[model samples]
Target: MALMITDECINCDVCEPECPNDAISQGAEIYVIDPNKCTECVGHYDTPQCVEVCPVDCIPKDPDHAETQDQLRAKYEKLVAAKG
Candidate 1:
């Protein structure tokens, strides 16, 4: 499943650089995760890096964009291919 940055985010700016997929970005207020680009580090690491580094623990799975591990891996592969 894709992860989301909640309103509880303190905008510490730690999560953005930690995202391997480049899915996190500054929004009007807090950071936002682009579900289309989010693979939760499926291809890069065992755990989502952004969640690991976030100080507030505000990042959580986005139920609205629920996806299986296979789907996330597929998305990660697609993203990698697109970068080439």
Candidate 2:
């Protein structure tokens, strides 16, 4: 599943830099995660770095954008290919 930053986010700006996919960004009120770019760190780490570093535990799996691990991996590959 792709992760999402909830309204509970404190906007501390910690999660943005931790995202390997560059999916996290500062929204008007809190941090936001782009589902299209979110791979749950499947290609870069064993765990989601944003969730690991989030101080308020606001990051959670996005039920609206549910995806399997294999899907996440494919998304990661697509993102990498886009960059090259």
TM-score of each: 0.98, 0.98
Q: Quote the positional error of residue 39 for candidate 2 in Å.
A: 0.2
lDDT of 2 at 48: 96
Cα deviation at 16, candidate 1, in Å, is: 0.5
**C-alpha RMSD values across all candidates:** 0.5, 0.5
- Model 1, 1-84: lDDT tens digits are 899989999989999988888899999999999999999999899999998998889999999999999999999999999999
Q: Model 2 misses residue 49 by how many Å?
A: 0.2
lDDT by residue (tens digit), candidate 2, 1-84: 899999999888888988989998888888899999999999899999998998899999999999999999999999999999
List the pairs of residues colliding in candidate 2: none
- In candidate 2, what residue range of length 10 has the lowest lDDT sum? 24-33
Off by over 4 Å in 2: none
